[model samples]
Target: MTLTLYTNPQSRGRIARWMVEETGAPYEAVILDYSTTMKDEGYRAINPMLKVPAIRHDDRIVTECAAICAYLAEAFPEAELDPRPGELADYYRWLFFAAGPLEQAVTNASMGVTPNENQQRMVGYGDFARVIDVLEQAVGRAPYIAGDRFTAADVYVGSGVMWYTQFGLVEKRPVFLDYIARLQERPAYRRAAEKDDAALAAAASGDQGG
Candidate 1:
């Protein structure tokens, strides 16, 4: 069955587009305007949250950027974007780490919210410093997140690294700089960037016209 991708240029949907490019999958993209289209009834049926970056493959529907990355990797085995079954510990570990701890840490930091000492214990990310240190070590040890091979984990984690570093939300350590440099070298990543940039430009022009 043909795949349908629901996305907005400015949203996390860019990550899903990159994953689709990596998979070499032919899919139709449905770009929704941030104003009203996303809240429409048709789009709401696919995602109750009315969010972008959801995918429909045959009878299956997948939401969430990280979930979509992993799903696409598994769906297209020829892409070789996932580690073998037995060697998947790091794959699952860092993917969730980026999605959960790393994301929360960055968000908290961006919002200028620092929990008290006692509250830190209850926080999933502990502290931003600790989260950065762990993530730096994880990527520093290997060229890719899931050991020697590049996997879907990198798509999600790398996107976080790329976005965070670009906006100065995270420290630009040498390890992160090098890792993002490597990710940028990929053809799929370049293709996705160009496509998103064009989409954003078009949207801006449309807004100016109306």
Candidate 2:
């Protein structure tokens, strides 16, 4: 099986990289730049959205970081990233929650787009505070998002928690920080981060030499 990941070190592609690392699958990485290669017609054929973090497995293409995580978990089940029997509910729940509501709320909040009570009804996440409260309760409930063991859910959710807290996009609640701390201990997480950091450094060096 041939698997290829198209990503940029500076984008949400890092989350996809982490999920790929968690799957323990052999794959090739094709790094793209936002201004040029990513938007080129050749790359647009792969993803019309013109975004990083898309993957091609054989002939099948998958885009979006959340979808990539879920796909990789199922694709490499031997890695045990897929949810266990009882974990299905929580697994999908928090996975979509992070992908949809959490992300929407955070992005809107970051752009100073708080919804009024009436607008909240139309917004899927209701309000930023509500989303944060629910998320806090979620991580506080168990060792992992899907229960006792880490699953693809944590990879997506943990990335959100880590990024959100780091940028102050969300309130740096203790629960969020603690949850991120647990995920940081994973070997896959560390490896993925180091790879991205090295990629970033390489890009910087190239720019300097130019």
Candidate 3:
């Protein structure tokens, strides 16, 4: 089956790109621009949300960066990104935790949307500080998010730590920096970043020429 990735260079699509690279599978990338191709009717057919980073694996369509990471891990078993028997609990637990609470907490904090004490009960992450503390504990507990080995969960959570820290959305704690440093050293991660960086440069050059 052929895998196709629909993404933009400068979005959460980078997370999906890294996941695809980790699979070591041959795939086609369809780059979309937010104001043009991304909003087109044809693209909307694949994702009504008009979002990038959606993948078409033969007849299957998977959207959301976390979902894409998890789906690709399962789809390409040879990649060994899937969790082993002993790692199952930590794998699913942290993966969903990063996708749900962590993301919500970071994004909300970035936009100055902190919830009050009463409102904290209604939110899944409670508060930004608590979320950061929990995340610090998670990454500090092991060499990888799911256990001693790296898995698809790291792709999502690592990307979150990398991006959040770089952009000041989250704190640059010793643990987060250490975790992301390890992940950044991976060949697949390097390759994915180079590709996106080239794309971003090309887009900027095009804008200047026009």
Instruction: Compose the digit string of candidate 2's lDDT tens values, residues 138-169.
Output: 99999999999999999999999999989989
- Per-prediction TM-score: 0.96, 0.97, 0.97
Better of 1 and 2 by lDDT: 2
Q: Which parts of model 1 are misplaced by more than 4 Å?
A: 207-210
**lDDT of model number 2:** 0.92
Q: lDDT: which candidate is best?
A: 3
lDDT values of the candidates?
0.91, 0.92, 0.92
Put the candidates in lDDT order, highest first: 3, 2, 1
* Clash number for each model: 0, 0, 0
Off by over 4 Å in 2: 207-210
Q: What range of 10 consecutive residues in model 3 has the weakest lDDT sum?
A: 201-210
Q: Compose the digit string of candidate 1's lDDT tens values, residues 33-98.
A: 877889999989999998889999988999999999999999999999977885599999999999
What value does the lDDT take at residue 28 in candidate 1? 85
Cα shift from native, residue 125, model 2 (Å): 1.2
TM-score of 2: 0.97
Residue 122 of model 1, lDDT score? 90
